[model samples]
Target: MAAVDDQTPRAQLTASPDGRVTIPAPLRRAAGIEPGRRLVAYVEDGRVVLEEWEHLLRRVQRRVIAATSGHSGSAADALIADRRAEAAHEDVSADATLAGRGAHGPDPA
Candidate 1:
């Protein structure tokens, strides 16, 4: 449970006849929303949370940093490359083993 902090930003929204709400320009700008941009919405803590995909990714990234204690630096790319190389090597080795076995499969004598 989080304590109530009145410092939270608030805004009023109005829905049209078809239940479509028009987000005020100021709020939309603050949230990085642009014209014709798509928003992702979900229910969290009994409230609707909406934001652009990039913004949501940034929020999750921030949490990851805190959880990892700043250890999630730029090593992801290198790690992925290393794993792919290992998989490719295993594939080549398997193919070579299969070819070698076929040559000595059986002596037809």
Candidate 2:
């Protein structure tokens, strides 16, 4: 018996002893939820939010785009840049090791 805005679609749902709740057909249709549709549920701002998997995916994608909007290039580009940095570090380490060694091998302790 939670209070919701009158303008928003509201339904009284009763959970079974096993904690299963049924979403009414009207609400389901309004939310574009069909039978066997995948759903993601979580609490947002102290309220429970149930979203379709597809909708959640799109929301996340939008967030990612907004976050990286200032940055140039795509995910693949970022990954390539990271890999290049790693390779350069490895090369520098190898060069240092080689410089520390004598022509034959490591110097006697």
Candidate 3:
């Protein structure tokens, strides 16, 4: 076991042949994993990995909410509205340029 730093507690552990590994208390606390909590495991790059349930989805939702919470509408609705407005603006500009070319028949030069 090794402590990476004094302030930020971290440790390294090895897995046993029986597939049992001990999780350090500080690391468990930081990861929000508690006793009796359920976890998901999957194989990646020939290595077995374990992660908390709903971990990925929850993390993405947290980031989205944090980024858009201050907007006028709800986070999800605001994102949709902003995207629609951008698309509409692009369409209007495109139509205006097309109309201008048709009316003026290109540059005088």
Candidate 4:
């Protein structure tokens, strides 16, 4: 366990057999944890981390911005361009096939 600094928030909690750990009112107030608010908990660097829903959302947004920062356009634009190329290829193939069999389309049976 890492040594706790005086400025870091501290609380002693006990978990019940059912695995529920209730946050004390003072700590909850200090942490801005509302009664009905959602939280995301995960282990990081061997320590348990509890993050509020909004905090996680902001963190993910930052990560996405960092990842796509160098791109000139959004990923959706690139996907649309690829789809258009595929559609054009299919159209050319269909035209070639139609030309081979005449405009009447494939012969019956």
Whole-model lDDT per candidate: 0.58, 0.63, 0.61, 0.63
- Which pairs of residues collide in model 2? none
For model 3, how does the per-residue alpha-carbon lDDT over 1-109 read when each residue is reduced to its tens digit? 3455667767888976654568899988877888866565546889655565456335545665676567776778887856755565565455444544443244444
Off by over 4 Å in 4: 1-9, 73-109
TM-score of 4: 0.57
lDDT of 2 at 41: 61
Worst 10 residues of 4 by lDDT: 98-107
In candidate 1, how many Å is residue 33 off?
1.2
lDDT of 1 by residue, 20-39 (tens): 56677776776677876645
Better of 2 and 3 by TM-score: 2
**C-alpha TM-scores of all predictions:** 0.40, 0.55, 0.38, 0.57
**Ten contiguous residues with the weakest lDDT in model 1:** 99-108
What tens digits encode model 2's per-residue C-alpha lDDT throughout 1-109?
Answer: 4576677677899876655568888888877888866665656889666766656556555655565556788889777666655565565445444434422343345
TM-score of 3: 0.38
Clashes of each: 0, 0, 0, 0
- Structure candidate 3, residue pairs in collision: none
